[model samples]
Target: MTTLPASAFLGGFALTFSLIVSLGAQNLFLLRQGLRREHVGAVVAFCILADILLMAAGVAGIGRLLQAVPGLAAWLTLGGAAFLAWYGYGAAQRAWRGGAGAAAARAAGTPLAATLLQAAAITLLNPHVYLDTVLLVGVAGSALAAEARPLFLAGAGSASLIWFAGLGYGARLLAPLFARPGAWRVLDGAVAAVMLLLAIGLLASLRGSLGIGQQP
Candidate 1:
């Protein structure tokens, strides 16, 4: 393998961070896990690993193959929208019945397997993740020479690491603020709103796709 300049690594890092820094389903889930102080390490690690694998695959040119498959993206989007709607309804219920005691109980009672499953769904079910990681990042990295691609991947992976680690661990600093039932209610309400909004957006996209396909 040939050595590449530090710019390749920095470019990857900057680009990946820019793409991922937004508060989406995955990031919101991680933030909630971090706040609960339940399996924060496992959740963060899983997210980082998942992101790296997707990025690597993107760099490996699997993005094109995925795009070539008909209806696959739409199917994923449908699944994601349904999951988001269900999750949002759950959050709304929690928000409606806000109580510090209930929140604490939930934090303590949630199973690790279940948490990880939600993490996986939040990460993998969303078509945007594939588009951002595989198509956008992958395409950018592919433009570089073969030797420089690794450096780019390293940079992108580093961004995922730094972002998830900080989001997970740094949430402890807000424990004092979230100590109140009111705070829990507000947070859950916001989460519910965002999740539902995202679900609606996904469904709208699918509708648009269907409309376009139906056109003569």
Candidate 2:
């Protein structure tokens, strides 16, 4: 039996936590669900499962397949950007209208299946998810000795589990603050801004890839 250094597990945990701690599209959606207190368990579970599967596939060399198909990345990026723009617009409209309390009431009545589907779209459709889990994390895992890969994956998976659980459940602690429509408006506005910024960033990256702004 081979003894893997503790660094493998620690490194994976730290890397994954840092990557996901940011306020990206997935995080925004998760936060919204958490705040709304609707299907939080299902949403968090799906997200954690998705991360584990993606990271595992990446470790198993799926990232190489993705790299071989550059056009797919472009397409995914385009799709993600368009979706973000649309979602951002909806959030902005909600913020402007200021019926968040009512909206939450309505969202509470939303079906679990529908909620899961939305969660799926948000998690699966984002190219950055692939980039982070498949390419970056995957490549990192592949670099490790075979025996160490499991420890790394365990660490990474643990981070996702912990983070999502906290984000989903911890949000209820702010239920009092979110009880106010005004607070919802502020949150929706912030969500809109973050989504739009992320969309713009994706578009910019796509353009750079296409060499659109380079001076000849």
Candidate 3:
């Protein structure tokens, strides 16, 4: 068996961290939960665990299977896009109505299972997660020498753990800032903007995939 270099591990870590750092649905949901101070540890752990599971599958070659199934990808992408768009619209509506922060904070009163389910939905419902992790990351990891693969996996896993942890815990510090109504409005506006951008990007990608917006 060959041993992977430390550099390979670092490279993998950077890739994973960069990819996960985006302001997507999963991150936004986690951030909201964190701000509410509800099951912060559980939410973070679930995200990290999900990342580990997905990364392992990617390293194990499941990503290739997903790539080979274009039909499956299309269906999953459509479903994920619809869900995201709906969620984004709903969030935006709530923000526009005002008191969204308080409402979200109150939602923290729900059962732990409910929160977990919400997190899972945000993470697993999106087909892009599989494409990003299993296919893209997996293919990248496969390019390294056999010995370096494990190091790369370690780096990616570390990024997930660190990122989710920071997202969950760091949100608490912003609670005081959000206590002011104006600040809450700004946060909601920011969240709405991120959600809308993600939705638009997904739709555009789907249009391109369907050959609806191609140049002659």
After superposing candidate 2 on the true structure, give the runs of residues whose Cα lies further than 4 Å from its correct spot.
1-5, 100-108
Flag the better candidate by lDDT, 1 or 2. 1
Query: TM-score of predicted model 3?
Result: 0.87
Candidate 2 worst ten-residue window by lDDT: 100-109
Q: What's every prediction's RMSD, in angstroms?
A: 2.1, 1.9, 2.6
Instruction: Please provide, for model 1 over 98-138, each residue's C-alpha lDDT reduced to its tens digit, 9 standing for 90 to 100.
Output: 77655666766688999899999988989899989999999
Model 3 weakest 10-residue run by lDDT: 99-108
When sorted by TM-score, best at the front, the candidate numbers are 1, 2, 3
Judged by lDDT, which candidate is best? 1
Expressed as tens digits, the lDDT of each residue in 126-192 for candidate 2 is 8899989998999999999998999999999999999999999999999999888889889989999
Per-residue lDDT value at 26 in model 2: 89
Over 51-135, each residue of candidate 3 has an lDDT whose tens digit, in order, gives: 8788878888888787777788777767777777777776676677667655665664758998898788778868778877887
Best by TM-score: 1
lDDT of 1 at 34: 85
The alpha-carbon lDDT assigned to residue 94 of candidate 1 equals 89
